[model samples]
Target: MTTVHERARPAAEVLEWGRATVDPAMREAVGALPDPVRHIAGYHFGWWDATGQPSEPTGKALRPTLTLLACQAVGGDVEAAVPAAVAVELVHDFSLLHDDVMDGDRTRRHRPTAWTVFGTGPAILTGDVLLTLAVELVAAAGPHARILTSAVLDLLGGQNADTSFEQRDDVTLSECVAMAVGKTGALLRVSCTLGALAGGATPDQVARLGLFGEHLGLAFQHVDDLLGIWGDPAATGKPVHSDLLNRKKSLPVVAALTSGTPAGDELASFYFAQPEFDPARAAALVEQAGGRDWSRERAAQLLRQALDTLNVAAPDTTATGELTALARMAVDRTH
Candidate 1:
């Protein structure tokens, strides 16, 4: 619900600080890679174009911000947790590169995907290098190294389920929810736990922070599902009707299908009968089945749960307040 004129937000300052601190280290990490791989990584980060021209950064770096916020929530200096933040961001980018490749997506971050520009083989290799680098970064963070690897396994499991869902019409809401947790929640959970650990939080605090992140991650994905079905391509930085074109069983779509309404029945017929989806008609069907409203309410519910969980963990502080506001914004985001 934020507009351009809403200059400062609860999490804006901390998130901005995180993006500033992490970018330099993130760039250096990418720079450390070998030639062609480094070049591809640079391009993916929007640091340089195919011809070495400078460009803009790709995303909001939300995962890194969450890491830094977790640090502050536990009384650690943001600078001290910079490496952990960078690690989370690196893994996120690694996932994005591989996701684009796997989904055959042409664009990301408002630019042609690396796989499209550098060829799929090179892009996948570059993603592999990034994943290795991410592990190395976390290994430097100490005993928590196992956590990052575990999260990666969960992330891959989620993505594997997602791809499988594409070929089947019998996908259940529970399966989709689990897939979302594995794909999206696992990393966010890792980010918060790693940050809390680096911040010297106790085991109890760290585990609680991770739980808060898991709820936030679920809310984040529900909003993402909303965006996929109804978001503007220019704002979302993707093609129009991107999910429907791929027949992605986003939560809203799942909700509509299981609503048992006539519109839901009609939508199912369209999904099964058509060779290619018509974005306009499909969108209309989803709306008719109350998909958008259902998704919005679900996101709000998850956001509330995240805030409640966060409260049980940390004391009332400016840092935790900002985190609460951020959890709210995560669900309300349009893109």
Candidate 2:
């Protein structure tokens, strides 16, 4: 495992460069949308508030970081990969905008969600525009337009599976993993592949980077489940037990549900009960059923796979250490 250096300045600088690439392209693209849609997009990304005042505290821009790092790891000029990085971040934000609407989430980054403030219609339309712009950003670059569209379809399908899981207690762990691969993994996976292609990587390197992204995405989602249930509100920017309150049937919950333990049976009862919330007992039950521990171990394993794949593809690069360090930091993040 790469040491997570305590020095924050260097990582911040890399992330700032990543954001610079993403923000300008995003703004220019959103500017092409109708005024109402543009405002929704801006507000969602925390460029402004509902009333158009400037704001901070947007998302972490993780996808673009992965994009840019993959480019550099493959010995490509970071500047050449800027357009693809922007495209990756745009697609990610588009997904988030729609996800908030579909989940009826009222807040994000400690601020009101775009759908809540501007209404679902505008928020959804903004997502459509962002998706279109994502395509346009990568069009001139000429790598994976069809692949990007397919990823969107995968995202939609994954979201559908997630929503459908709410009504069915029969969800297997395999099914849950597959749904996650489609919903979250596909986007991250392709971001790496596209970045490598932009960097003039060969087909083999592209596949390796894509695999690394896939594993990283899985680890990320599993860690997200942990945060949803137990992360500090200040760090996570959401209320504790948010997943429990929502009964989200996330990866860990599904793992516990299918564990076939006595605790699993008890956990199922709580999930099916009306007025659904018993945070303390729910936490205990999941722990007793081994969901929490299982998820933690699985996340660690997936992260290892991501790093191993990265090492295989790009044995030496000026940016390899940064890529490894960032990948590890992503899984370790509280949020």
Candidate 3:
């Protein structure tokens, strides 16, 4: 019930820092690449000025900010966490580059996706280079680097299962949860872990941070599911109801599909029968299936659990407040 003012930076400041972190070395690295690679990766990050010169494409570097914040919260030096912070952001961008290709998505962050501009092969290679760079950055953190690699591997594993789930109708709720834990939770967990490592937290503290990140990550996915269905395109910057178009088996969809209700039957019928359903129809279908309400309520519950884990981490009062603000900002985000 604490107001945002009770803790954390004002939302605007946090957002500013988040955007600033995305621009530095990674963009420079991409710009330094030879020929088509530079142009391709440059365009992906929105750095191409008119005439395809390097201009800035903006991103909210949420992962890196979280890494730095968590490090500070645990009394770690933010400077010490920079490598991990940058590493995670690089990995995140790398994932996005490849994910767009795999999802056949044409746009990201309100711009044409790397694959869309660069073609599949070059985009894939671009992701590869970034991923390698990510590992190198993490490795510079010394012993903690191995854990970071494991986190990336876990992310890849989760992504694999997620894509596979799209084709399979029998995916259970537990399986969905597991997939989310990997797909989203892994990097977040690593972020906290690295933060605690930088801060010299005890093993137990690191574990608690991992749990905090896990719960938060799960909550994040649930919120994303909500946004995917109902968020405005101007705000979300993605095609409205894109999840439905892709027939993405988000948590809510899976819950409704397995509910054994009349609505569930209708949902299954419509989803399988329609190949080219639009946003309005998809929203109608989701409503009929009771997914809208169910998802909102479920996401709320997961958010509470996430907060509980943060509480258990028992960060400093200021850090706790900041994290709470972060939680609110994440779930309460309209954009």
Q: Give the TM-score comparing model 1 with the true structure, all chains together.
A: 0.92
Which candidate would rank higher by TM-score, 1 or 2? 2
lDDT per residue as tens, model 2, 240-260: 787888888899999988999
Ranked candidates, highest lDDT first: 1, 2, 3
- How far is each candidate from the true structure, as Cα RMSD in Å? 3.6, 2.7, 2.9
Which sections of candidate 3 miss by over 4 Å?
A: 1-7, 18-39, 50-54, 276-282
Give the top-scoring candidate (lDDT): 1
Error of 1 at 111 (Å): 0.9
Q: Report the CA-based lDDT of candidate 3 relative to the real structure.
A: 0.76
Q: Which candidate has the top score in TM-score? A: 2
Model 3 lDDT tens row, 270-308 = 776777656576577667777777777766786788677
Residue pair clashes in candidate 3: 46-57, 47-55, 49-55
Q: Which pairs of residues have clashing backbones in candidate 1?
A: none
lDDT of 1: 0.84
The C-alpha local distance difference test score for the whole of candidate 2 amounts to 0.84
